[model samples]
Target chain A: MTSQLFSHDVQHTLDIAGIFVFALSGGLLAVRKNLDIFGIAMLAEATGLGGGVLRDLIIGAVPPAAFTDIGYFITPLAAAVVVFFLHPEVERINWTVQSLDALGLGLFAVTGTAKAHDYGLGAVASVALGVATAVGGGVIRDVLANEVPSLLRWDREIYAVPALAAAILVAVLIAAHALGPVTGTGAALVAFALRMLALRYGWR
Target chain B: MTSQLFSHDVQHTLDIAGIFVFALSGGLLAVRKNLDIFGIAMLAEATGLGGGVLRDLIIGAVPPAAFTDIGYFITPLAAAVVVFFLHPEVERINWTVQSLDALGLGLFAVTGTAKAHDYGLGAVASVALGVATAVGGGVIRDVLANEVPSLLRWDREIYAVPALAAAILVAVLIAAHALGPVTGTGAALVAFALRMLALRYGWR
Candidate 1:
């Protein structure tokens, strides 16, 4: 039971980190829009927690992580406050943020697929939820920023496709009972590299 | 069953009207942000359908209204397009837009309560969903506009409260087997009047 709890905590930590990166993206965009700190915080919270809350509620998890976990809620708030104070530095090192975002997307894609499967969803539905989890936050962030959702825009290169690949990897591993440490890390590495490559080469 | 379907259709029509008003509000706000047509359309869609889509998905409705009903998606697009072309008219009588917003809020509150009941949710949960439905679009709109969510702010008076009252009124009447022209219209009227008065006198 302690081992089980430890694993759950590890997964939750990854999810929280993913949400933080997503929130940072939203907060930075809010700054670009010349929003105040409060506005930045709101956008961060919306982009970071919105999709997970939606997914949890749909899956019959009540109260949502936004309401149940102060840690999750505070993570975005802290990220916003940091971005609030360090706008210039943030703007200068946006590349670092992008790298962290790619890492988050990969981890979150795996987490989402695994979570959906844990919720007893079939592999297909699990993969779909994984994609939703990975990209949903960004879609919402773009929509809130009053831009066409990058996910929906035809001009954007291979955004959702990388998330899909990650989800497929997890689904295949879980199906084969081969989601060992090496395989799990390999799957995440594949997703992270693919996303980074997509950003690098403008690959569609 | 025919009566039920008829009532559903009527509710759908009212929902369409609500979506129209909600879209108008979003479009106007996006204009204030100096966003382009695509940006305006994104805001309009977020404001018009975000709440209902959230409510439906929370209740395990798949694809969501904006995805399942082409009209729900198209309505906001059309409204945004109209606003893009007729900015002068929209600017001239913003008061009319506020009034329409009140009407939409009332309609959505009632419809959300009704739908929640149809799903056999408890009265409390139904009321929660109703409030969310009435305010969800605006929340999304404000988030996109980079403003603090009006519903969450104490400065906004009687937004969710009036919608809650309206939803409770409907739920009570339906429970009492006395839901008719009197209770239905009375609930909607009460909600609308409260919202209008809030708008006029600054009920916050």
Candidate 2:
């Protein structure tokens, strides 16, 4: 394993950031559901961490990060706490939540692809897993919260597509040995832009 | 690939039955989320069939049942339709939903274990996967619905544990070559009884 390819602190930061956004979405959905604080926290954690845990387990990554890292597990709890108190205000800023969601989706795609590649999977499989991981949490969240998953609906606003693009971008960068901060930023930027445009245009 | 184990019609029936219950749960949650019909159907499909699709993919079961058998996909949609029209009646019978949910959990666990055994995994791994398969959809459903999964919560009745027992029972029967209808039904009954008792006692 190349040190430059996978930095623990870097990955941890990205995962934490992703968890924050996912938990935010989950919390907001709980507000929509009119659930109590406990329900809100539960939803946030499940949405923020469930997909990555599933992906890692399927790939035989032991002690899935959610179990291993207290920080990753607690991030969603913190998010839930914030949302529990500020739910109405949070709902008032739906646009900001949506934007953060897009950013998180992009970051997760890149990180998921990187992790899959580290497990010696081929580029195609890695990218596919990345896409699955990026959206899988929301898919689960929507199903539990009883909304249609934005990714699977015919009216989806390019959710999975952006993840797909981000994964492909990461895989290409890795293949070309050009996956430094510049390319990483470019990949995240591309995914964010695509998702935002999709939202603005109501693209399905 | 044993000819004796291939029961296409039975599998079809079970799939549909499972879809009915699963989609009901998902659709009910969607109603809770206040999503539209499209969102309800989307969640219904995800919660109803996503686990099986995921299991098949992991086991390298090509094309997957969702693709090969139209019924597998259609069942969830049908279920969504039913719930869309009859949610009030269904909601009134919460206990019935819980009972049926336990049944679905038991059946899925057994089937998941059998499938994993067919894929040549060890007993421990197969049982774990079985538990995952049985509860994964519900977990996803909770996350999407923005609620804490009843299974993961400390206060709810024991859910996944009974499914785990059922899977272990089925695995033992299969190993002993005594997994006829009698044994299968016996094991399922045990699971159902355990779940019911737990509910009655408010066991966590």
lDDT of 1 by residue, A86-185 (tens): 9889888988888888888887777777777777889999889988888888887776667788888778777788888988998998888777556765
Interface RMSD of each: 7.0, 7.8
Q: Which stretches of candidate 2 lie above 4 Å from their native place?
A: B1-115, B118-204
Model 1 lDDT per residue over B1-204, tens place: 112422667767888989999999899889989999999999999999999997887666666777888889899999899889997899798889888888898878877776776666666666667777998999878876877566645445657768878989877877787666556767877899998898888876
Itemize residue pairs with steric clashes in candidate 1. A144-B144
For candidate 2, the per-residue lDDT at B146 reads 63
Candidate 2, B44-109: lDDT as tens digits: 877887677677767766434554455666777787887789889889998998788778877777
**Number of backbone clashes in candidate 2:** 11
Backbone clash count for every predicted candidate, in the order shown: 1, 11
